[model samples]
Target chain A: MDIDMSLVDWSRAQFALTAMYHWIFVPLTLGMTFMIAIMETIYVRTGKEEWKRITKFWGKLFGINFAIGVATGIILEFEFGTNWSNYSWFVGDIFGAPLAIEGIMAFFMESTFIAIMFFGWNKVSKKFHLTSTWLVAIGANLSALWILVANAWMQSPVGTVFNPDMARNEMVNFWEVLFSPVAINKFLHTISNGYVVSAIFIIGVSAWFLLKKRNIVFAKKSILVAATFGLVTSIFLALTGDGSAYEVAQKQPMKLAAMEGLYDGKTEAGLVVVGALTPGKEAGDDKDAYIFKIEVPKMLSWLGYRSGDAFVPGVNDLVYGNEEQGLISAEEKIERGKVAVQTLTEYKTAKDEGDMETLAQLSPLFDRETSEGQEFYENYFRYFGYGYLNAPGDIIPNVPMVFYSFHIMVGLGFFFILFFFLVLWFTVKNKIDSKKWLLRLSLLTMPLAFIASQAGWIVAEVGRQPWVIQDLMPTVAAVTRLDASAVQLTFVLFAIIFTTLLVAEISIMVKAIKTGPKENEGGK
Target chain B: MNRRNIFARVLFFYVDGFRNLSGWGKKLWIIILLKGIVIFVLMKLLFFPNVLNQNYDTDAERSNHVLETLTKSK
Candidate 1:
């Protein structure tokens, strides 16, 4: 069976692009739904017409976001079977459980309540209707939670065991996997980030309204609520981001190395903020032959190990020679390096080698029985013939996407702190409405918050690069073999449908915002 | 107490509690349910699988066994 590597690459690329685009709307739905619930509950409690107006306004937006989220999400599920058939088969048992539960428990609860929340306003009592809204919010967040759990499992697989008999991985205990450290931390970080995204979204839109002097009463109140939420969440996010980085360093050293663009182990590594990593170069170079260059400071160790003097391996260290001067024999170390190099070469060659015997030997060694061998092989393979092999003992992360994304996310985090603080200061001093420029800037910053949240997630997921589940399974090995054409067709179809849904959502939201909530004819 | 009197007393307590809850507690409860129970439980179930005891050593091995079982059944 001849498999075209281009086709797989194309399909995978399409899938990632589509999923990412779809995800832009998902966290908003999850976070905004909760915010809407809060707004509506406030209305129900205070019986203030203003709160009701706020509730109705945000509810409309949530509805639109939710629809787009659902539409885009459905496409991803199909892609797994169609594009990654082998992956489905490989981790289906462990992977299928969470997805099934998500569908049956979380999806069902969320969808059912969402319908009630949307259409039940007139039919149900105020209390029942409010309850429905709360349920819908619960449902949406639950959906995110379940999906993250599945992703987290992929990030840090737990409670599973190797079955030499079955020649694959299988679930051993469901409980152990659920409570894995990675899953718990990732879940908190993701949901909190979602909240931050929604808060920024609210602040941005409200600031725009204030700048325009439209719905001043509602906009002021909305901004107050949103800014408060955004400020707090941003602070939380900064802390969580730190913790997540620490975890990444511990579990995914390669990803950490990639993020910092470290080519050699050093006592103190500088954190590169915004720099181009030219794939095959030394730290200091002036020409095209310069491979990987990054800004340096000892910040990597400070962040990852919490000590400036901590030793962090660079790409070269991981690939080449990094042993105690006399701890191990030189011959043995070279042999180890050779084995690692051979494994990586075999895997890559098998993709294009067309030799069955060589592939057979290479493939099984990458299996559970010899994953250590696979890792060593991959590290060496990365060093050999890559033109950037001069500092072979360094560890390089396949994380160009993550490195930039992380910085962008962190940069935005600080931006929000300043933006919200200024808004709060102005508002308290009764000068918020008087300052049109600040209002406009605040309004514009909302999308930036959402962007930061999305980018943060991208870094978290993409940084894990080669592993689907940390050290347990490599993504390449997890993929299923289905016709690439099928994946392409589905991807195109989804792209069209999702775009339409997004357009419709925006139109509806625009109409709702323009119309505003109707004034109560007679105080009910 | 007489049935009428008992009903009246119960109604008074219910209205009083409702009024208090309507101010802020209701809103807080809703937020908690949405963020805490719904999202937390779902994410836990999906992203983090329940790892039962098995004879295998690695997650990949266990995953393969499960897949084989499912395939065999299919």
Candidate 2:
């Protein structure tokens, strides 16, 4: 059966579209819920009616973001079963566990507490209401935890052994899958990024209020909390980002190479602080990868290996093989992967035919308990996705996209730390209202937070392209063989529906912000 | 909070919340409702279905279908 490359492209586009849209709402929910919880805690402690009003106001915005997040989130999961059923079947045993756990967390925890947090205002005790708000925050972050665990498994598949008879990877140790270093780093990095985005969101909205000379007290207090949270989380974000880079260097060298636009292997490689990619740069070419570059010396090596002298492979090294570094070329992996694919089919055929002799011989090759099986699994079966590719170049992801997105995300991250510090300093000095330039910049920074968040995800996903589950399955092999037009149609429909929802959300949010917390009404 | 009583409180909590929404809340609720209908109702029911589960009843059958689909030359 010939592959419909168009179908593969459309499925990728649709999934990316849904994921990107879902993300816009999720960070706000993650960040704003905690901030709202903090505000409500102050109300409970101080017995202040004004703090309660502020909590209610921010909670209202959080609720608006949360609703759309739930809708888009469901669609993203279903896209797996619908469009990428091949990936669903291959790793479903391992992948579905996290998502199912996430569902339980979202339903039993987040939904239940969020209702009480939002609506049980006057009906519940102050402490109980505050506890409910905190639970909602924890529940939402836990949901992120499970999903990132699942995503991390795709980036660096572990704790699963492939069973030829079932034609799927089965989870062996649940703890190993859960606590994989990649999962921990990814979960922490992602949540902190959300916190930073949320802090920016709060500061921006408050800055707008300050600019208009409306709710001066409200805006200043919000900025104080947001800036403090932002500064702390921005530091956490950088630390986890370094941890993520280390994990990527170890488990996904191709992604690391793409991220840096590195073409030649090096010891003590410089981390590109700012650079432009040379036009039409390709791996193994004579052309230099960067047009002009400025880099922090030895940072890349130190980031990846904790040693400034450590060797770091690049695109050319990954593609063309480096025997000195024990790196097998993509071409060699494809050859071994072809044999593994063929042998799996033969083994299945033998088992079905009741060929006991052949089965006896082949069984050990799939069994990790056996030495032969361990070797075969490690060397060949590990490269199974490579068999699906037509050329060595197919192994490389969209390098320029990953490069630019990664740079943008990292550059903005450093800027945010300074931005938050300055915002807090100016506000603390009682000069926030007077600083019109800073106030306008704060308002403008909100969209940049959204961009940085989106760029971070783009770097993670696009940097690991071709493989849906790194070295286990390429996206071309993973996509369900639906007609191209069907996917195109659904993609358009989702585009329209999501756009409509986005518009409605913004309209409702702008109106809610314009209205501000009901000055006349309190604790209904 | 016993289980049934807690459940009842949540049920009424949501009901009362919906009942008491002011203009902005109601507008947001409308978007939520319309979007819920479009996504969970229309999209899930009409557009997207679990292909393997819908087509095959047993695990063995589903596995066989997926294996054939994946290992086949593209």
Which 10-residue window of candidate 2 chain A scores lowest in summed lDDT?
A515-524
C-alpha lDDT (0 to 100) for residue A430 of candidate 1 = 69
lDDT of 2 by residue, A411-462 (tens): 9999999999999999899898999998999988999999999999999999
Over 4 Å off, model 1: A1-3, A122-127, A274-298, A325-399, A482-486, A521-524, B1-74
Q: All candidates: CA RMSD in angstroms? A: 10.6, 1.6
DockQ of each: 0.05, 0.62
Superposed model 2: Cα runs more than 4 Å off: A522-524, B1-11
Alpha-carbon shift of residue A222 in model 2 (angstroms): 0.5
What does candidate 1's lDDT look like per residue over B1-74, in tens digits?
Answer: 89999789646544554455422235433543543432235433332222322245775565544444323221
